[model samples]
Target: MVDTSDLLPKTPRYLKVPLIILNTILWLLGIVLVACGGYALSKLSHLDDIINVSLPAGIIVIGVFFLVLTVVGCVVAYKEKLVGLVFYTVFMLILLVCLIGVGGGAFSYRNDAAKPIGTAWDKATNDERNIAQEFFDCCCWTDANSTCGSNCQVVNETGSVVPNLNKTTCNITVVDYVQKNLYVAGAAGVTVGVIEFISMLFALFLIVRICKNPRPKSYD
Candidate 1:
């Protein structure tokens, strides 16, 4: 019977420790992303009318993928499995492509962002309207109607505001809010891509190193 242990690739000491450290970073990053995505989805889902669910959902997807990569990387490093290392490198490439696609697509979407945002105003629930109004210190979408949300208020009595304090409309408020957050997401995606790219290089190096110098079988 053949011993399977000998088939594992030998991880050189120089790269081995660094690879483990990189995988640990991936693990922490995955946790942060998953948490952030989940929080955004749960706490801010009501604003979906103005912002798409795909944003948070995409974050969760990338976070989970990173988690998987962390496991794969750890295993390959510990077991010195060449096959697993190759797969790790492949997964890293796929992740990098996805990051570029998502980041690029999101930035493109931002270029014409106002169109959908303008349309979404009408579809917002009253609760969402109130939330946006309060946060942006606005009244109505048009602020033309005499009626207003919580954000608009008369001063006290004597020196009271003529109608309400906020002069801007919710329409303007929501648009600005969404655009800023979108920029943040795009930047974060780029950062993740950079990290994945570096990890990919490390994996490739480990693969070549293993191929050139396979670990010798143990003598009993």
Candidate 2:
């Protein structure tokens, strides 16, 4: 029989250790991303009407994708499976593309968030306004003196109207809050994308090394 053993790639000792360590770190990062997504969703759930529900949902999806990718990466790195490494690399590339797209969308949305926020404020019923006011700790959607019905009350503990409290309207405050959050999300996407790019490069380097010298060695 032809010796197939010689065709197998021998994994270097140095490469094995770093691969395991890096993959483990990646796995933990994936868990952290998932938790971040869950937290974001929980926070956004309170403002269901005013915020875009899809954004939090998308974060959750991305987190889950990273989790899956991490698991696959660990398995491939442990087994030193060349095909699995290639698949992992390709998946990472796809994920990097997705992250870039998400980042761009978030950054672009920051500029466009004001209009939607205004519309939501305009369409807000009394209950919705109260919810927003109570959550944001603000008085009215616009100026404090502007008509906001019963929800625009800026009262102190003694039921006395708190002067100048209404000056800080939810329109400005909420819009600023949303824009800040979008910027944060965009930054996070870019950061994760860079990490994914690095991971792909590592995988490709291993793939090339394995192709050069096909030998098999057990890491366990």
Candidate 3:
């Protein structure tokens, strides 16, 4: 009888390609999260007493976790290690939960950012209000009637003189500023969470496939 074992087709290596791609995408996402978290921490450094510092720090920590996950995943994929794959998948599931929570919190916080902004304005003293008005180029919290003096002057971006009669208020300016940053953070969180969710599913699939088609043992 002819030896037919030699004619058997070897398992294609394509199964691992998706896992590699997903890990790479996750690594890039982690980098972005770290950058955003760092930037936010710097921007909010002045408000450390008012805002919670833990939020930004948590983001940075999560980013670092993702980076570590990527490294572990790459090693497991290269070595076709079943135990490492299982560990990575479990860790990913845990991270998915955290990411969901963070994304929800960010979105909710962005929606309600106006309250804290108004509170800050209310707490500021007259001198502080004046300094804010000068920096933001606004008259008062809501309108001229709120606190803007009768002779408040408005300057346009072109350095042209404009009547401060109906200029934008500090309330709108500050609220807009806060909301804009929050929006960016919220969107990023949601996007990263979604990507991670997909990654978790892909990883689980990879684990199953690897289990079925176990890598050949080397005697070396």
**Residue-pair clashes per candidate:** 0, 5, 0
RMSD of each: 7.1, 6.3, 7.6
Global CA lDDT of candidate 1, please? Answer: 0.74
Q: Put down candidate 2 lDDT per residue, 62-89, tens digits, no spaces.
A: 8788888878887886676889999988
lDDT of 2: 0.74
Instruction: Give residue 183's lDDT in candidate 2 (0 to 100).
Output: 90
The TM-scores, one per candidate, come to: 0.77, 0.79, 0.73
CA lDDT, every model vs. true structure: 0.74, 0.74, 0.71
Writing each residue's lDDT as its tens digit, candidate 3 over 121-196 gives 6675656666666656676766434554334556789997544646578778866766676677667777877777
lDDT of 3 at 56: 74
Stretches of candidate 1 exceeding 4 Å from the true structure = 1-11, 125-137, 143-167
Pairs in steric clash, model 3:
none
Mind giving the per-residue lDDT tens digits that candidate 1 earns over 54-170?
887888898899998888898887667889989888888888898888788778877777788766766766576677666667776664553354445466668855346347776
